[model samples]
Structures are given as structure tokens and as C-alpha cells.
Target: MATNQNFIGGFQVNRHLLIAGAALTGAGALIGLTGTVIVGAALASAGRGWVRQLDTPPSELATRKLHQARAASLAGLEAWRTGTDGSPN
Candidate 1:
């Protein structure tokens, strides 16, 4: 008589399937861990940059420039709405 069976530690199981499942599980875990590390590093770097920006005070010239730019944009919008900018309707 001939038989085909696999026994491991007194347990009859398919060894090939078990090994393949383990390899797949490990690969998934590795990819998940790598993604987590990359995201964590990116967040950490951004936090550092944010902290640095918070520690610095805005320059007077830069603030003035921002205000001027905002005023100019608002004026342009107003002129366009009233058709005072002289562009063809």
C-alpha cells in the first residue's frame, strides 16, 4: 500500500500552504511597518519646521508687503465689480 501525507510534530498539516501563508503575512507586516515609519518621519520633520516658524517673529517689511498685496487685490476686485477698470464688457 502507498500513502501520501505530511506530519509535523505529530500533527497532519499541509506544510507548503503553511509556509506560503507565513511568507505572505510577513511581507504584509513589513510593508505596513515601512509605511508607518515613513509617515512618522515626515510628520516629525513638519513639526520641527512648524516649531521653528512659531519661534520666529514676522518681519515688519514682510508684514507691510503682505498688507499691501491684500489691499491691491481687494482694490482690483472692487474696480472689476464696478466696471471701473475700463475692460470691455
Candidate 2:
């Protein structure tokens, strides 16, 4: 009977497989870290832009958005009062 030196009991341990697994694990970790960094940078940039917007008074566009939102809410209330929400007559 012939037995490999890397065999323990009845199981054989392959060095190449272990090395490949370790390399893949390292690559996955690096990729995850890079993605996290990119997302964090994008969030930071967006936050800064939001802060810059807040430093200025509301623009005409902002006022128009607010008015539009109020108008939509009023329209919704009117619809509710009129029972136009798809109810069986």
C-alpha cells in the first residue's frame, strides 16, 4: 500500500487548494472594502452638497415644489371627500 506524506488518517490535504482558497478569500475581502469606500465617498459628497444647499435661502424651484406638494395634498383631500377612491357605489 502507498500513502502520501500529506495524508492524515484516511483524508488527504492538498496544499494547492488551501492556497487558492486563501487567495480567493483575500480578494473578496479587498473587493468588499473597495465597495464600502466608494459608497462612503459618494454619501459624503452628497451630504456636502446638501449642506451647501441649506446655506442658501429657498430658491424659486424649492418654493414651487412646496406649492406643488401643498396643492397635491389639497387635491387628495378633495378626492377623499368626493369618495373618488374606487369604492363600489
Candidate 3:
């Protein structure tokens, strides 16, 4: 008489499914890590800008220097415009 040797209702577990699930989970974790790194870099850049803006003394000094430079340039331009030839006063 012939006899069956297979057990567990003759149902075999698919190895492909297990491998595919692991690969998908690893890919998702890598994507999540990459997204976190990108967000951290962006936040650092924005935080630097915020800190620079918050430093009132340095910002004021820079603004004063810029205004002085602009005024000097305007004065030089006026002097050149009123001169006989384009020679600087």
C-alpha cells in the first residue's frame, strides 16, 4: 500500500514571501532614516539664520556699516557727477 509522508496538512511555507517582506521592511527603514537626516540638515540651516538674526549687537553694527558705506558711495557719485570730467573729488 502507498503512504503519504508529508505533514502539516501538506502545506508548505513560501520562502519568497518571507524574503520579500524582509527586503521591503529594510527599504522602509532606510527611507525613514534618510528623511530624518534631510530634515535635521534643513533645521540646522534655519536655526543658524535665526541665531544670526537674534544677535542684535552684531546685526546693528552690520547695518550701521552698510548704511555708512552706501552714504559714502552716494557722496562719491555726486562729487563725480558735478565735476568737470569724471575725476573724483
**Model 1 bad stretches (over 4 Å):** 1-11, 56-89
How do the residues 9-71 of candidate 3 rate in per-residue lDDT, one tens digit apiece?
A: 785556667678999999999999999999999999998898777857677889999999999
Model 2 accuracy (lDDT, Cα)? 0.83
- 1-89 in candidate 1: lDDT tens per residue? 12325566655656677788999999999999999999999999998787667745456657988999999999999988987966676
Cα displacement (angstroms), candidate 3, residue 11, comes to 8.3
RMSD of 3: 10.4
The 10-residue segment with the lowest total lDDT in model 2: 1-10
Please report, as a residue range, the 10-residue window in candidate 3 with the lowest summed lDDT: 1-10
lDDT, candidate 2, 1-89, per-residue tens = 23333455767656677778999999999999999999999999998888777855467668989999999999999999988996777
My TM-score estimates for the predictions, one after another, are 0.50, 0.51, 0.48
Total backbone collisions for each predicted model: 0, 0, 0
Q: Answer with 1 or 2, whichever has the higher lDDT.
A: 2
- In model 2, residue pairs whose N, Cα or C atoms come closer than 3 Å (at least 3 residues apart or on different chains), thus clashing, are none
